[model samples]
Target: MNKSKSLTIINLAEKAKFYTSLCLGTVAFVSVFAFLFLIPFVVDPAITSLMADYDTVPVTCIATNHIYTEGISNCSWSSCKEGCTKEATRCHQIYVNYSKIPFREFKYQSHVSWDVVETRFLINPEGCGYPPSVNCSHFAKQYGYTTAGTPFPCYYSRVYPEMVVARYSWDDTLRHLVLSLAIPNLLFVASVGVLSYWYCPGCGRTCQKYMHHFPAEEDEYEENTYYNSQSFTKIHG
Candidate 1:
């Protein structure tokens, strides 16, 4: 009786463990998709909107000098070790001289990097490219200020006087939104579909049974055709 009871307990435990796998798999797939892919998309746009506080500084203000700078932007050391690349990061800032304002000088430095002066300004708070790599010479020609004496517009935040940028990067926000929706939903579906195949006993059994029957069914059909052909030959011969 005791031996039989122990066997029953073992069988019950195994069934419980197997039944729990589906629940675990559901949670794992949902959490991984939500945290890794979705949250960043939500957080980034909110932050970008806040950075969009800056507005264009008047074009009437003359830019006395335009400075173009270059620097090496590096991936993490681990990323580099894993064969990632380093790209050059370039920044352009124009020194704006306000002829009609309290602040005699203002710097139009529309970059993602942090600058700590009140007179500094940007066109959009989000600044330049994903990494802001616009060539200084190209920027000069495009903005109609080749050497920086010509007036160019940059933006500044009313609330945060020091906060400035060239343009709000709504494109990055849109890209993130699309990727978050597309990639996560696809990944979640695939992950859950694969996990269900293993976690659900009935699904596994159905697939396995079908696979097992396929070869036998094919062979049986072939055999029947061969036997019928042989019989016809015997009769007609």
Candidate 2:
């Protein structure tokens, strides 16, 4: 092949290699990010949502005046008494006074009945206390009615100072997944696109402008040289 043609082929090859390297580098970065950050934050929640039998039950908050929050309320207790009575096997309530008594340790376990499962939190009196605003008597009354036949009410009202129990929600898991995985992934993709376009080989503004101006200057110099050589040959002839 002619010298110019050979040079053009070599340049094309080099540009192809460079572009391929950039593509590979982008893929590597995305892979690493997905493994280190995305999988745990994003994939885990989706899997948990699919595989786990039930969404995590929130912490139960039992209040005074026979008020219960999160699980079952006082009024509905009668109608659902069968399930509620059955639930007694797996469910129970606890109160602690955080202000008066320091929490020493918190623990919990799961109880399964037939195909159903219930998570129960164990509160230690040494670490449990009641918040000032809560009415312990109401919780005691509610507990008394619900576990009329069971030994649960005795455990529910035994708080040192009397405190309410609350559980973390599934919404927290979703929120974390979005913040850690979804948002970061989107930002990374957008940044990579912007950067790739800005520095792309022939498509980049600076590269295109340089390639345009540089070839014209080279051609102009070659033409000038050719004319000078012709003038010298004619003079000699």
Candidate 3:
């Protein structure tokens, strides 16, 4: 009976260790993929925002008009069987025009047009997405555009007078920045745990082999009670 009990204890210990190690391995694997895919949204923008290089000065701006982008042209019946859901991209140029400060429009919302397209597609360095998923027909439906001739508050970079922003986003910049740094570090730690768990099987596994000898609190208490009763009977007899 005692021999069988000892074998059961060892088996339990082995299984426990195996599951623990497996969980660590899984976390490490997931962390790696998460960090890689999140780089564009988190890391890139964070680095630029953290630098504090660009200080925006307040400026009054107006949405003069809208010009469509060629992204919709690339869509065809074969390619866009779903009816060309590509959001209309536009020339969001914000610069000084005719003695007035013209700022780039933010998100492309309503005000649809197939003509008046941008001939030269300019890139925004601080923008998110790798291939740019922001401009889409679905995306436009969700967001809204300010009406033309409406005066709104805008910001312009002090150094770059030509550059203009619809609004400033310190909150997103800071949040994404933290997540960008935190996720990679978390991945690194999880990886180290996975490595250490598998690397020293002989060393750690040996200790784990004996872990089942330590009974659960309830079991230990029950056993102790039984042993004390037996000892008391012997003494009383």
Candidate 4:
């Protein structure tokens, strides 16, 4: 090829290689990050929500226990005489349960047990007739409750301890697995494959045409022609 044409082809090949390398590198970095970080955060929540919609299994409570906190009072003797008595009490109820269908069975027959607990807090404000001398104001402050005015009667209750299972049908599980794990990897591999096809030396058309011309054969032919020309010049001189 002529010098200018060869130089142009060489520049085009170099630009192609640079862009292909950049594209492959970006794909690799993003794939790694998505697998390690982004995928887990997204897939876990989606899986959990999906399971909640279709895979909740109920089990009976095998054992139960109730723990009560000491009653607290906020009324002084004078206030108590004026029927301004207030008290706060808290109870924690704990339960032990076993899965109905063996939620998770191990080969060794040993597995971790799960427990559930419920907490309830009650506030009672009555006159001096009440027995316990609990300091309701102190209880409210200690338990992070509001005590703006006279502590009115109130109660709070909540249940605890939840379990999530991957209990979808075979088809659903397969679909989620493919979406979460296979798709990203396949996309990355496809991108690398395309880049390799476009920029690989000796194989890709761009690289073969520009970056890897058969210069060794051309050099050998030129050397032979120069030798033949010199011999002719000597003979004529």
| Candidate 1 positional error at 138, Å | 1.3
lDDT tens digits, residues 1-237, model 4?
A: 599999999999998878878877798668867766635444654454454343343222222222334444321111122122234233222222333333333223455353332222222111122225444344334333332222121211112124312122434534765676876787688877777676567566665676546786788889999999999999998
How do the predictions measure up, each by TM-score? 0.37, 0.28, 0.52, 0.31
* lDDT of candidate 4 at residue 79, scale 0 to 100: 15
Q: Which ten residues in a row have the lowest lDDT in candidate 4?
A: 151-160
Best by TM-score: 3
What order do candidates take by lDDT, descending? 1, 3, 4, 2
lDDT of 3 by residue, 163-210 (tens): 444435666667877877797768779766666857766868777767
Residue 109 lDDT, candidate 1, scale 0-100 = 41
For candidate 3, the 10 contiguous residues with the lowest summed lDDT are 75-84
Model 4 lDDT, residue 66, Cα: 26
- Itemize residue pairs with steric clashes in candidate 3: 87-136, 87-137
Separate clash counts for every candidate:
10, 13, 2, 6
Off by over 4 Å in 3: 52-58, 71-146, 194-198, 201-237
lDDT values of the candidates?
A: 0.50, 0.42, 0.49, 0.43
Superposition-based RMSD of candidate 1 using all C-alpha atoms, in angstroms: 16.5
Residues 1-237 of candidate 1 have per-residue lDDT tens digits of 999999999999888866766665676678675856445435454355555443333323444554455554321111001111324354445444433231223344432222332243333333333224434344445543554555444445556654444444456656766666666567666767766776678997888899989899999999999999999999999
Give model 2's TM-score versus the native structure: 0.28
Q: Which has the greatest lDDT?
A: 1
